[model samples]
Target chain A: MHEDRQQFIQGVRDCLPTLLGYIGIGAAFGIVGASSNVSLLEIALLSLLVYAGSAQFIICALFVVHTPIPVIVATTFIVNLRHFLMGLAIAPAFSQYSMKQNVLLGTLLTDETFGVAASKLTKQTKLNASWMHGLNITAYLCWLLSSLAGAMLGQWIEEPTVFGLDFALPAMFVALLIIQLQQQAAGKLMHLLAVVGYTIIFMVVFSFVVPSHLAVLLSTMSAATIGVLTKR
Target chain B: MTISTTMLLIIIGCCLVTLIPRIAPFILLKKVSLPKWMTDWLSYIPICILTALIVQGMWTAEQGKLIISWHYMLALIPTVIAALWTRSLAVTVIVGVVAMALVRMFS
Candidate 1:
């Protein structure tokens, strides 16, 4: 029991870096949501429930364009379907725990938390429900608070783009890719690079042919499938 | 037609779609067994997804042509260096955002 507490705390501490990224993105989200007239209560609900940054941002953008509700909902589903892979990635760690507990922990598994948790798993070679609880919950709270703060303070934060705040997500992805790579077995980096190469090609070809998000999903699925197949 | 009702409807749709993807995998995994080959595939998903997202942002498609935005690429240089050197996401993001801001300010 004491060990679980310690793990949870460590999970929280590891999330410190994500705090900065989440605040920048989340606050920007709030500013955008407010300007678009999305109610503060609605924003809170989205953060509390939807909890996916990219999807939330897209929701705000789609709202501005007066996108149809069905389209927006469908886009949100496709954009966030990757969350399934992320959930599956970490599922093994909590296999012994009850399904309810697993769902509870998985609810908070954002991109940032998944990256942090996956890295920790690679290094520690052992994982606990406690550590995951700490990481997921801490990051979740930061996202909610930061975006809400941004919404409430939107007047002052008028132009997050002027400061290149939008680049934060891509930058975080770049850093995460590099960090995830650092954990790959040395000689096997070729397979990882193959996946990347395939993704770039697929994304380039598909982006022109299909909606970009679908292209992205296709690229990920195809590249990852090829990656696993080619690995001996 | 009011914003509140429309927004409420949208939010309800979002919550269902969003929650299903995130939560269903865990619940389904417990109930059904996946093949060993499929499990091997999960670990590779992260790199592919992250790559697809980043690379997709680096270029734009124009009228019958493709163009790479050098400014974003230029900004990524420092971000990449910071990521590789410091290996800290906070540092990399700060560098990245500042670099892009500077790039925008200048050119």
Candidate 2:
């Protein structure tokens, strides 16, 4: 029991740096939400529930655009569909754990957390619920706190534009993409194909799409199809 | 909609969306094994999906007007550099934010 407690604490410690990043990004999301007429409570609640960086950004953008609720919901669903697959990919690692453990871990499984957790699993043979709980709790707390701070500060700062904060989301995404591309094990051709396919499809479809959701759906479907065909 | 009500609805909606994908695989695939072909395809999904999202986020325009401002171009430099060097999320965000602020100040 003591060993479990120690491992749990260690897991949280390992997750600290990533959690800090989540907090900063989450705070930015909160600021955007508040500026766009979303209440502080709403921002906080969404941060707690969604806990997804990109999805939250997209939803916040939709709010700024005054998009319909159904569109917003559907877009978020499509955008976050990868998380489902990610959950499945990692599920086998936790097969020996209880259902409650599975659900709890699932809630905390963001892209960063999954990458870290999956890598750790590869090096270590044992899978413990405590480590997952600790890592997730640390991330969750950071996200909540940063979002709250953003909400509070957002109320005072009328225009985030004055501080040039509006571009943070895109910048962050760009940085993440660069890193992802750098780590590709499938070779340069795969990377080029993915990039070229995505750009062409996104531009072509986005030009004529009525519901913006179609843009993401069509791009993903077409890209995945191309990836499968060319991978062989 | 009232502020609180909108917040509630958004939260509920996000929760529902997040839960569906996270839980769907476990319930449906508990007894079934994913075929080799499907797994191979799944391996590449992240790269493709994320590339599309990043491109859209970086270049998408509002109201048919392009925004290729100096600030955005300036931010890209540090973002790419930091991502290449550290692969640290915190560093990436900090560098990007700092670059934007500096660009806005100087240009």
In model 2, the runs with Cα more than 4 Å from the true position are A1-7, A54-72, A115-130, A161-221, B1-3, B61-73
Query: Which regions of candidate 1 fall more than 4 Å away from where they truly are?
Result: A123-126, B1-3, B61-67
Give i-RMS (Å) per prediction.
2.2, 3.8
lDDT of 2 by residue, B2-103 (tens): 455555676688789987787666554444667877765555545554555545544445576544455576677887788789887667777777777787
The clash number for model 2 is 0
Best by DockQ: 1
lDDT (10s digit) by residue, model 1, range B1-106: 1347777888889988888878877788777767888877877777888888788778877764668888788888998899999889999999988998999989
Model 2, A6-45: lDDT tens digits are: 9799889878756545766677777777887787767777
Which 10 consecutive residues of model 1 chain B have the lowest summed lDDT?
B1-10
